[model samples]
Target: MLTVDFDRLGVKPGDRAIDIGAGAGRHSFELYRRGADVTAFDRSADDMKAVAEMFAAMELEGEVPADARACAEVGDALELPYADETFDVVLISEVLEHVPQDVRAIEELTRVLKPGGVAAITVPRWFPEKICWALSDAYHEVEGGHIRIYKADELAAKLTAAGLTIRGRDHAHALHAPYWWLKCAVGVDNDDNVLTKAYHKLLVWDLMHKPWLTRSLESVLDPVMGKSVVFYVEKPVVPVAAR
Candidate 1:
């Protein structure tokens, strides 16, 4: 279920981590479970409230470490509320395409990460996303839908320009791509279409069961048709002379 691989990102216990654009707090919950002091930041107040409640529920169920702290904050990505160099780790997953000024948002993410801190960013990969756009205007033309498609190189350049050094990269969720194509071909909003409904059921089963066959197939397909591309980056420590 995680697009950003935490092990590859080097997430550790006690790290101060922020999940920017943390819709539904999936990544935030994972961070908390890993014993991070986690913050789930988003623009939606109602979503933040739900996230906060979930964090509290996790605490009550002893799912999180006693010392692990987490909270939800409603905020703008272009203007993060935290001070510069505050967090040890940052996660911006499936979010950049929604921001018109994505570069500014990247700059803000970089500014808040402490020097040497790492971030994991994920986005919809170009070819699959392009296919979705071509199939359905409703997919991209919605009120808060994706605004742009990013070629891997273009995204890497933008992050480099913002002073983050790319450390690693990978593709994920190859099995889910065709399901989306089906949705777009039917109707993005049409949940009742037989093909779309069947595909959705299959995806749900794959998620819950994670059978070896589908997993193996997805691994084989990931490099070629993965729906999302992930980048791991680090903010370099400034030399004393520069300071």
Candidate 2:
């Protein structure tokens, strides 16, 4: 499911965008459909391979605009392969919590974004994530699993320190919090729990149909218990005289 609001991010056709840690290429695929020159970057070669296949499939199916382009790159987020100011937009969602050197990755994000360009970043919201941790150690205690939970203001401060201006912030997937809590309570790996299974089915249905009742409910609940907190930030463009 999409987290960043592209309309708020002001992504338009021809924008050079990258989705860092693009696990399954969800956001990257959206970017191509929005007519962007998009790159899906991840450390996992297997994931990148899958993303490449999806990109080719999208192109073949005419799912993306004619002028749009997409590719996948496998790399470290702490050291993106591109040069300075290479992208008009950058996105990293649900990724930083897993990186031990998250600040370095943020700095790399600042370095690669063009002046005046925007980036959308998301992390698990503090309270909900805390609940998950409290409910079960297994929820996060695994290789490549979440290593930390972020408080919104703390994340904003880190971005500011990295020279990105915080433009906006919001919470998303409010309806998802309880479902995760249930899974954590029952067992992180146990889908056989009747209540958990029922909740999972409900979530899948909500994802597929997005009925108005659930949509409106989630909108109301997001600020209270949203699973993910999103930030929109911009790199300052120096005036000619200042430069």
Candidate 3:
């Protein structure tokens, strides 16, 4: 299931797109399928290796346009391995809350995006995540888990400070919020719990089939309790100072 909406992100054929902290290449694969020259960057070597293999598999399956290109690179989000103004689109989905220096990471993302380019950044919405934290210490206290919780305004302000203008914002994955609450209530690692297992099956079925009932329900619920909040922002064609 995708968090950031690519149509809203203004993806186009041949766009130079990068997915920063692309954990499982979900967005990167979508970008490639849409004919963008895609880069899937992450901090994990093993993840990147798997992503690269998937890219090749996709190519073999003719999943991407022949002209579209993709590669996976393992790197630090703090110091992106690209020159300034390099990518036409940038995505950092469900990643910022994990970073200790989120503002600095935002600066790095902003720096690499071409002027007038758009980006989609997402993070766990405050209340749902807060519930998870309250329910279980194991949820956010673990390594590589969330280091902080971002209030919507706080995150938007930081992006503005990095010279990005917020174009739009949205909330998504409303159904997943309750599932996480369930997990936190039981044990984050407890797949053995009957209720948790049942919920997982439901979620998996929803992902695979995407039947209309669940989709309609999610659409109605998304604005209320979406697990992730997405922000669409753009760099000004003329520098913000110039205007």
Candidate 4:
């Protein structure tokens, strides 16, 4: 399921967009469908390879706009390969928490974004993530797992310090919070637990079908129990005199 709201991010046709740390190209594929020139950049070679294959498959299937382009790149978040002011839009979803130098990663995001361009950043909400940490270390202690929790205000301050102005904010995936809590309770890695398995099935169904009941419930509960918090921001356009 997608975390960041593309509408809020202002992704338009022909926009140059990069999904930094794109795990499986969910956002990148969405961007392509919206007619963006998309780069699905990730540190994982295997994931990038799969994403590249999917890009080609989508092209063959005519899923994306005829003019839209998409490619997967193996890259580092802390040191993006593009030149400064490269992309019109950037998506950094569920990635910062895994990076030891989150600020540097944020800086890199800012650096690659064109002046006045927008970005959407998503992370696990503090309360639910805190509960996950309290219930099980295994949930976050593994390699590439979340290194630390981020309070909403702390994250905002960091982004502002890196020259992005916060434009909007929202929470998402309220129904998924309890599922994670269940996993943490039973055992973070225990896929065989009856409750966990049942919950996973329900979530899968919800994602695939998005029935009215769950959709309405999630809309109501999002403000309170949402698992992910999203922030939309813009890089300030530099004045000619300042330049």
- RMSD (Cα, Å) for all candidates, in order, is 0.8, 0.8, 1.3, 0.7
Can you give the TM-score per candidate against the true fold?
A: 0.98, 0.98, 0.98, 0.99
Q: Over the full model, what C-alpha lDDT does candidate 1 score relative to the true structure?
A: 0.96
The digit string of per-residue lDDT tens for model 2 on 84-143 reads: 999999999999999999999999999999999999999999999999999999999998
- Candidate 1 residue lDDT tens string, 29-123: 99999999999999999999999999999999999999999999999999998899999999999999999999999999999999999999999
Pairing residues by index, what is the TM-score of model 2? Answer: 0.98
Clashing pairs in 3: none
Q: Cα deviation of 4 in candidate 4 (Å)?
A: 1.1
Residue pairs with clashing backbones, model 1: none
Q: What lDDT tens digits, residue by residue, belong to model 3 across residues 22-107?
A: 99999999999999999999999999999999999999999999999999999999999899999999999999999999989999
Q: Candidate 1, which segments miss by more than 4 Å at Cα?
A: none
* Model 4 residue 48 lDDT score: 97
Off by more than 4 A, model 4 = none
Worst window of 10 by summed lDDT in candidate 1: 195-204
